[model samples]
Target: MAPTLPFRDINVHASPSHYAFSSPSSPSSPTLVVDRPSGDLRLHDGKLLGTQRVSSIAGILGIIKLRLDKYIIVITKAQPMGRLKGHMIYKVIATEFLPLRERPLHDPDEDTYLSLIKTLLKTGPMYFSYSFDLTNSFQRQAESDTSAPLWKRTDDRFFWNRFVQTDLIDFRTGGGNAHGFRQSLGQQPGMDPYILPVMFGMLEIKNTSIKGKPLTFVLITRRSRHRAGTRYFSRGIDEYGHVSNFNETEQAIILNDDSSSGLGGFAGDLGYQNGKIGGAAAQERQVLSYVQTRGSVPVYWAEVNTLKYTPTLQIRGVESATQAAKLHFDEQIRLYGDNWLVNLVNQKGRERRVKEAYEQLVKSLVSAPTEDTEADRVTREKFHIVEPERQKHELDRLHYIYFDFHNETKGLRWHRAQLLMEQLREPILQHGYFRGVDPPAVATESKSGTDRRLW
Candidate 1:
């Protein structure tokens, strides 16, 4: 696979009929053209005549359609956040929307939709990288196929622009008249250089030394787009088991044994292929990553706002709560083995109901019977007789813990958190974490394989 060279500085030109995006650094690169009448996107080799330069942008984010017309979103400004394994990550600081229509639409609802899109872009935190796959963790990237494009391998849950980038992706995949366009433009069949994937999350990088060794600590939190909303507006699990406000937080530490190594040596290495370093140059760096998730309780409950200090708490769908909880836990177990569900709600008052409901739902799942046939039951009986301990351990997977945060941390005694730690210390220690080293031979293997490797 050829190396990916992202377009860094793009010049935007607007003609009366279309808009053209071209890179000033690489003049030979194909220009992205968007027709004004139909909002169709294509590649152009020659510049559009009689066009005026509109703005300089970092990259094209994607295109979104309002009630009246389609508008292309572009990154007007971006700032470097940090680097991971030589890949420079950037955060979208400002953005601008260019309407595909030459004239403005007078529809009333179009303004509201446009305002909503602007609000989301302004408030949401978005980050992207030219070479790095920001939607996936280090472990996932190490195991994934390296030959594929970055956009194809992105996790849909964190790909914030996935829906809006459908046209571009389809064009690249030969969905419509892309074949003729690619043939005319002489573009390759691999990843499209202009199709950029943006992730909505929080990222922080700190450079410091630990015991005379160079260390880089990074914290990234990715919010799930499924059933996402502000608190008090969205709550509980849906029919598909998606919870509100779900987020994955990852803390990564990159340590280098060679103190003489500079940041320039780490740039553009692409180091996570098959759990091995990119080349001999990056063999001294060691990476360790740990991920944890937080979400609303995966049960049928909601807080209804009634213009009061406290909203009314309601728990519905009691009959289907068990199935929903099962779906949620099953997926969790499949992704991260042996879930350690820590409930941090009050044990009394209105919160007590939620706490009890959660406990009961977990208990039912643990005690539920399996739909086994006669032959399957006989085989299980024999296997259990031979390996009872292993069978029991496999059968009982979920562990639940309840702690009253408000009651324990009352009177400014925040040290009471030690109690919760004491209860979870054993399980956490046993669960362990993920570490990636330079050589594939010396890397620590995950005991549970892919299941324990957090995304």
Candidate 2:
């Protein structure tokens, strides 16, 4: 079946954009600011847009337990979570076992799978999941929406001036058979508001290395920020790698000396002016030899083998659904467009149709309804979001990932996890970018999934 989502599920508190830091904490629950705009925490009005029941204990517990296994945790079916002026959100109850490898639960309209993978790796073996939130993320409907990048945190503690803090509830794993999901942060559950399942879902990948097991599926979630000129893009090195190669010759260096004064040690007066070197000094004279060297792998080249693509687009100048369709067709222009204004000259069965629809949609924007945007809609665009800011993006909630074994070491295996996390992060977090300020980078690397050859 085609993938679907419901956005209304998570806004239980529907808290305002700003929440104070001083608040009380429940027994096991995390802490939060008590002085919110309103008293309701669901963050939503008393309106149940739709209701469906999940017929499994795991599904019910998935919402509360962190260590629930992949098999036991069940989630409600995807549904429309919420909707604002420019976009819509879908929600799910949370599930344990996911769809088959062939059937991925990714954003059908965009490439969000890899971003989620990277988030999981960074907090690999997370003690347990923490309170989830999406305010601090660089969000967008698509990956290439490079409007306003939020990763440039004024301070590491704050993403967009929201001083967020979380209580680690303990990360849980479904324990395959007996593994049991029970992981926590350094000493206790992390008290950072941005660390949660969604954080794992928002990695903007650069590259990944696998091990004995092959990662087969790439799952990603959607984001909340979408604005005009959003230049969204994401990449993972399938063939090329970001890691620099090691130098066979430029190994560690050690200093040695043979000629010393009489006492070798610090002496006074005319000390050791005529003496020879000591046994230690003689030993130092022995030429330095290579102990070992880490090999080099061409990052650009490695990217080729593991190459993957995430769709990118902008939401500007689009009035009607037809315009949206044309923008979709125009993705090729964003990817392959090389000359200036030449993209305007494209023609084909699909391209022609999409362009036609987009032109029609542009006409509708003239008389669209009016709704005051909360903040400067133009400024809320997301692009090139940084490492931490991406954690709060709604799209970073992927839990099920498969790693295809293609000759990767355990360290490299862990690297794959990291790659999956970073790649899921939004690129160029600006809304204007989606409006075609820049073309998304093309897939230049290979996808052979081989050990990167070091230079």
For this target, which candidate reaches the highest lDDT against the unseen true structure? 1
> Residue-wise lDDT of candidate 2 within 115-211, one digit each (tens)?
3433432333111111112222211111322222222111121111121111112221111111233333233221222222222112111112244
Candidate 1 regions exceeding 4 Å error are: 3-6, 104-108, 176-191, 257-283, 368-395, 439-455
In candidate 2, what residue range of length 10 has the lowest lDDT sum?
430-439
Question: How would you encode candidate 1's per-residue C-alpha lDDT over 227-251 as one tens digit per residue?
Answer: 8888998988888878888887878
- CA lDDT of each prediction against the hidden true structure: 0.71, 0.22
C-alpha positional error of residue 323 in candidate 1 after TM-score superposition, expressed in Å: 3.6
* C-alpha TM-score for every candidate: 0.81, 0.19
Stretch of 10 with least lDDT, candidate 1: 380-389
